[model samples]
Target: MVQSLARAGCEVTLVLKAPVRTGRLVDPLRGLPGVTVHSPHAAGRIPDHAVMVPRWAAGVLAELDEADPFDLVVVRGRQIAAKLAAGPLAGRLWTYLTDVPQHPAEFTGAAFGELRRIADASRMLLCQTEELRCFMESAVPATAGKSVLFPPVVALPEGLEPRAEGAPAGRALKLVYTGKFAPRWNTYEMTRLPARLTVDAEVHMIGDKVHVDPGDPGYAPRMQAALESAPGVVWHGGHPRAEAMRLTAACDVGLSWRHPSLDSSLELSTKLLECGLLNVPVVLNRTPMHERLFGADYPLFVATEDDVADALDRVAKDPELYALAAARCRAAAEDYTLDASSARLAGYLADAFPAADEKVLAAGGGRKLRVGIAGHDLKFFTRLLDYLNSRPDMEVRVDHWSALRVHDPAKGEELLDWADVILCEWCGPNALWYAERKRPGQRLLVRLHRFELYADWPRKLAIDNVDKVICVSPHYRDLTLAKTGWPSDKVVVIPNWVDDKQLDRPKLEGAEHHLGFIGLAPSRKRFDLALDVLEELRRDDPRFTLFVKSKLPWDYWWIWQKPEERAHFEEAFRRVRRSPLLSGGVVFDDYGRDVAAWLRRIGFVLSTSDDESFHLAPAEGMAAGAVPALLNWPGADTIYDTRWIHRSTTEMAQSIADTVRLGRWDADRRDGRAQVRAAYGLDEVCAQLVDALAGHAPADLGPAMMR
Candidate 1:
């Protein structure tokens, strides 16, 4: 977002929670005259800083109000950002939802409810494809006229030279696949391209380990040998996304392959759009998801392994068919561009918050005000609490009401009798009943996280009495409002904030062949794929060491409702756990505590999550100096474009091996901590929170509250 806005001539001032060292990524922006970047003091402990997640919320919002005011504000979540957008002094507030709330396989009644709420709250909503827009609109009637079907931006550097090979008319078929390749990619099959196809093809793969490690003991060698022995196959170790795109455009055939999984089954492929932008005809796997985006009549559809050759042959044989596919590709590319979507979205920003441009500061005008939250299970709420409490001027207080109900006649009255603001997270059954009985003027703030949206709680709660409703993501907000059938004006978007001070520190030098993953194993989390990547790494590079750490209690895995899914996950996790030794039973002699400590010895971190709201572990691991090997496309098409997301595990293993072979750790070693501190860190984010809050606080929010 910062990059696109900067390119569009906005005076881009990025106030990051941390500083990320993208090496040459910032070089172009550094040369830009209008771009200015700022870093604030991290909110928590100095070194190895903890994100003061709550305080940073209001702090950052307030800072933006004090700094140059923005004409339009687009917030990612319904958390703190929503509150700031609805607050006074804010301009056009556009709540943008990247993910449609519906989880294909994990939809408990609770998850479905959450999806509905987000759809209802959005005055203006953006969907990745027209099909997604239809889904969103059908799910929520409020979105019927207000939603816009726009694809995500295919962002490339403004003036980089186009790929060396333009549209291939008569060139040898050089096929290229880029991005993260995890177990979900079905890489064993991908690496067997020569065996799968009967045509003359040279395959080149550039992959990352964002989601899983393919170099583990069981799966690595076979995958590597498959590619190594394949005729005319060249594996380029993974490179940055921009570089990969440039190189991909040079090839004759572009591969945007995806193995259908819980997440992949519903996702719109970014690579397909990338290929389309470059006017490349894609031979895509035929799936309901792809059909939704490209329509059933689209020329590119591969039904089975047997169909692969014929599809390729047809494209090879007929120039007219090739030209037609290329033309369709170019036309399909138009919808995904940032320009087309931005134009349709600007109006929503104007309508949602008419007072955003008013320039009214907080109650005391630049002074911070402390706020308090009353909730339990602080794990999920901690970040918001920390950000709210971290500002130099803001103080935060939390009051836990064990098993307290928002609608309990006695509890609701007793809970907020003396509190400044009462925050109800996932309010229980009697929420509406209690909210109705509350005093007329009590400031009642209700928060709708993922749980409330997916569950039936929204239906039971009467949101009318609540003075404010807050959500974590715009998608969540839309989901909540749609499910709860609430007014759009009643909701707000506030994103969670993190502190990333460590991103600026110098990275370790000369260390190679280290991989790390810290997460609970699940299909949603993609632990199976992580193991595959590890297996692949071991086969491609012997010097490489796989580091695995799991803090999840073992009992979680033991208690599985679905035997098969649980068994699959457990077996994979076990393989990753046992992968520290070679076949002769030799231990690597070093495995550090936690992923961060392990990063000090390793060159890359495998962040393999199938679904995440905003993955903190991978970003944190990356900040700890582990080059992020991102699973390119995950649930809801979430991507962090941090030069880490790879396309395949083969690419990931090759990347690690190449780094070890060339003694070239420095070239790819990013100043991870700096990047985290600047953008993902807690302090800078808190300031933005303050600025956003001050800019959008309700007209009568009383004395300015600091984090």
Candidate 2:
């Protein structure tokens, strides 16, 4: 169970029972990825080959002091659970009951009394069958809602045996049974089954005489005598479990029969699932449980000798019927395989430890809040995550589109269910996904920056379900409200964060006239206007030069795909190459590491974009103590102070030259850096986000937008 669960990507920690009868499996269990094996002390001081039981209470109790908390704790019975209740993790307890005696005659103080106590204390009762669960609920009414059916599961064999080159062609239909023959099972009925068959049939009984009671020593001899009298019966004594499966594979059909009077109607036969998984059909006594699992039309449901004979004869008469029955059995077995069982178990455990809905942090003690971030581009948010990481109460999880933009719906659902609060970065597909799938008690926030306003994302996204729709600036907030009809109360304006710590580095000598522009390739960024600013500044002093810090325009797919845009940049770049005033004077520094150092080389930063919600380059440059020469973009006054905003490209160029000439640039530089630090420092921005996430309104939530 642990191995299969671990293989399915779950972290499994197994607390093994004593002496670990798991001799050969112990090493294999330890080697599986994400699987941890712990051994509890045995029941005795001395080694006893017989009756090895766990004296695990001491070891388990000691482990509780140091080990990390578990989402669930599953024990076998009352005494063990009672022992574990002494620890701090008592709340995460569950119990799996095995071989429960449901009959009133077996209800001694040792059985029913102990079971009732465990049922009352446990968080849930995991049982082997629905029949067993119903009986348990009636016997202990406190366990009524807790009981769940945990059916028997079989591992599908990995390797199949290759048949001999010329194996026998027209042989009898060979039947097999690979379990002990106790008298209660009515095993003597198998001796006459061969005679009742219409087709030539043989029965192979392979097992040790394990059913012989100490009081009835003659039982083994009697069974041997009955087997010898049976026609076409091959008796193979005692084989290992794996060998028995292999032996069953080399047969035509597996057989298991019992009278329904002995509580057999309520119980399941493990052999039925085993044979079904091997693609071998079985003939079992007609019962309601089997009918529900294998379907009512399954050809092998039988009761007496005549019914058993009829089921087999029908399969033998037509090859298609036999093939169809075998296929049906394999399909039925799919739900009972180990892989299927582990997945269901994982889901149960997930529900047992659901993500907390409320995210209030109590006084004194700290908590790790599950912060989920969903987005298309993670670059902006990822840079600011370090600030949140410094806090004692936050744990961040990032979700993005998978490779090739192929979304896994199930994986997305798991992340949604696991988070206390989800922050969607853009108002695109990712935001729409959370909007549609957000659960009832979960807090969901979507961030709308500039680009999403042009795309149809804002119109398609369901903002009514969102707790908050954050905009990077007040201008975008007003624009988004005007365009999308979002509730005005939910609209918030939190500025984009800039890492102030990464700035304030040492500047290079003679860099006062080295004007810098970042991200020049985009047509909307208006590099031509910035170059015009450079053209004006260069008329006085040839020392003035333009420094561009951006990705080469040709490398960007979005820019290169449009022929007009590409030619526009190509012509601009050619002019820079042709004129001596712009030729060797203009420096094209490709995008690289050390952004802080790159910003330090330039005395002034230019923002000549046609439009922007909250331009971050100026904020980053201001933090580096550079003067920002701006050609007023639409809403530029909202992002920066009006002193920095200019009316045209000529005005921006004059401001740059006048600042350097008057030597008043130092005061402007000092104030600009302080202004940026006050408005959009990384720490304050992260706190605003976490406050909203923890279900609180930060004092700094932006100016209210009226509908």
Candidate 3:
């Protein structure tokens, strides 16, 4: 979480317990840029309890006072949390509750009072799951609105893959149990799993005997004895977290079936997720929590020892089943990664702290660009804004002309005067408005994406005020030249930006058969062509499915406004609805945030748009190792090689089939990825924009102003 915050460009100071036993966790964080690890070293003995907590908190506060007021105080351990919550940092607190007490009903005296104080003081409570969140909220109704589901975080290990079920025939399926062996975990049941199983099994237990309390001396001994007596079990003494994960990765299933002490509905074991992170399937007791995290189809859930035996038998009988389960488990584990969970944490922190992201770094570009960007809908140009923000030399301000003042001249004039250069996205009345009020030296750059070409806005644009017209594609530039009658020299083609780094990912198995399309509903986008390609592919192989990453077509009234256009889409929709092959095979996934992960499930991405400025979705998919099957368009050749482009739907289908069968798919994927990296990288596009801006600038500003 610290690393994620630091990476997201936040200053982080990690406060740990005194006499820090620095190892794998602390050392790496200490080395990260913008990270400071502050552990208070004791001057003398200071016992941790209510007596010293106030004094200790004061000292901690004194240390924190040296810096500006902390945006958010992330209090981790339960012992020190109450003290921190009650202290000066009460309001900006986000209490992380990792280990909930098993006996919450017994909370009384100081414990109950402290718990209430912490819950009341905190801005938000972090729970591992919604189930746990509900449990905490029920226990303290004061926490109901504040708590957020903070899932278990395990960073994806590099070069780590789930154990493939390719072991030699009749090889024993290894079941590993590694975590706390306290009574609630049913450690004895886990140890007995191998003996109860009909299939050959080996249960390797690796964890420390958890000490619940100093008074309960008998608990650890009894648990350890039960583990030792169990047949077909090997008890390895506790290893460090990293080593345990490494050992667990070599096993087949992570074992965690136990007696449901307390409401099992609320319990979500982190170790099972740890196994999941390592791509090891889990043999867990079926619970509502488990079902929510892992879909109902998760085959390894066990109700009893006999059920455990049956699950083992079922997996052993078909190794492929184990492989598929492992794959699905690995897939499910992506959502719970440390980086993924930290985004949620960052959001809570942003709400609490508010100014962390806006905090400026000391060193920046010598002269800020003072770039004013005006747009009606900036949906297409968000990447451009991101690029401008990343550069220290650029300071950007945006005005939404459509949302604020649909036809107001005063607001547009104010925007034009604020900027040295004003770039209008979606060249319509917005461009015309900018062009009308531009000063002598001020530069105007208008970018025209595909949708605006058909609109009546092009002819109305004041070409004289516009110093440069940025087209997403060369074809759009030519079409705009004919429509607006702008001189050839005034227009330039800068491709749509693609962050190549995010797009590159490890492709999943059977992805080659998965066909993906980004937008499905639009008629001009030619979503039906994608279906046609999928149908053609399925004739040869049933595995083919067109995965349409889209918003619902009904949401956009523009596509249905024209009766003929609506009928065309309706016929296609009818075909998809009527045919079993088209209906089941056409997968509709709403446009998602994690495009890179979605790309991993697809082997080929289709750009079947009848008209396009630049088809970025296929390029993004290709960057993630998916082969591009592009439909021929005016500017298609300028972006991709002719080999990947097809003149017709049949040609596109044939191209996909040939690429798969003749082993050109991998090579084509590589070529498409390389093309995107070379042409549409943020740095590459930024340079082009800078150079163009420099060319249009007056001689007063030197070439240094270009970047």
TM-score per model over all chains? 0.44, 0.49, 0.62
Among the numbered candidates, top TM-score falls to: 3
Report the candidate with higher lDDT, 1 versus 3.
Answer: 3
Best candidate, lDDT: 2
lDDT of 1: 0.55
What tens digits encode model 2's per-residue C-alpha lDDT throughout 1-707? Answer: 67556755577777655567656667767888898776544535324454323334535644643567665566766557655555554545677777567676667877766676666666667777655665566565556545665677886444765222221238888888878877656676776677888788888888876477577787677777767767878888788666788888788777876665753545577787888888787777666567667777888877777787888888877777777677766787787788888776776554444333334443112467777887767767864553454344667777776531456777679888888788888778888888999888777888887878989888888887788988888888889889988778888877788777547644555567888888887788888888888888888877888899889878899888999889879888888888666766788876753456577678888899988888888888888888887877777788888888899888887888888899877788888888888788765676577667776764348632111
Error of 3 at 196 (Å): 9.2
lDDT of 3 at 434: 78
**Candidate 3 TM-score, true structure as reference:** 0.62
Stretches of candidate 1 exceeding 4 Å from the true structure: 3-13, 30-36, 41-58, 66-72, 77-93, 104-123, 137-146, 158-171, 210-217, 227-229, 261-266, 287-296, 346-707
Cα lDDT for residue 391, model 2?
48
> In model 3, which regions exceed 4 Å deviation?
1-12, 17-36, 39-178, 182-186, 189-224, 228-366, 404-414, 579-583, 591-594, 693-707
- Residue 416's lDDT within candidate 2 is 87
After TM-score superposition, the amount by which residue 89's alpha carbon in candidate 3 deviates from its true location, in angstroms, is: 14
Off by over 4 Å in 2: 18-22, 40-69, 77-89, 104-110, 161-169, 213-218, 227-229, 263-265, 355-707
* Candidate 2 residue 171 C-alpha distance from true site, Å: 1.0
Cα lDDT tens digits, model 3, 1-707, are 68667765678888655565556677878888999887555333344322345457556765675567776676776767777776777766778876555456755667667766888887668777655665565565566546776766777455666555453255777888887776666676677777777777888889776656466678777667766776778788888877788788888888777775533546466677777778788777767566656767788887777787888778777778787667667777887777787676675554343221111221112355667888778877765675565455557788777552385566667777777778888777778777888888787888887667888777787887788888876667778888878887787777777767546655655788899988776687887778888888888878888887778677789866878778778888898899766768887775645565567789988888876777888777867889888888777776777777888989888878887889877887887777777777755676667555545323221111100
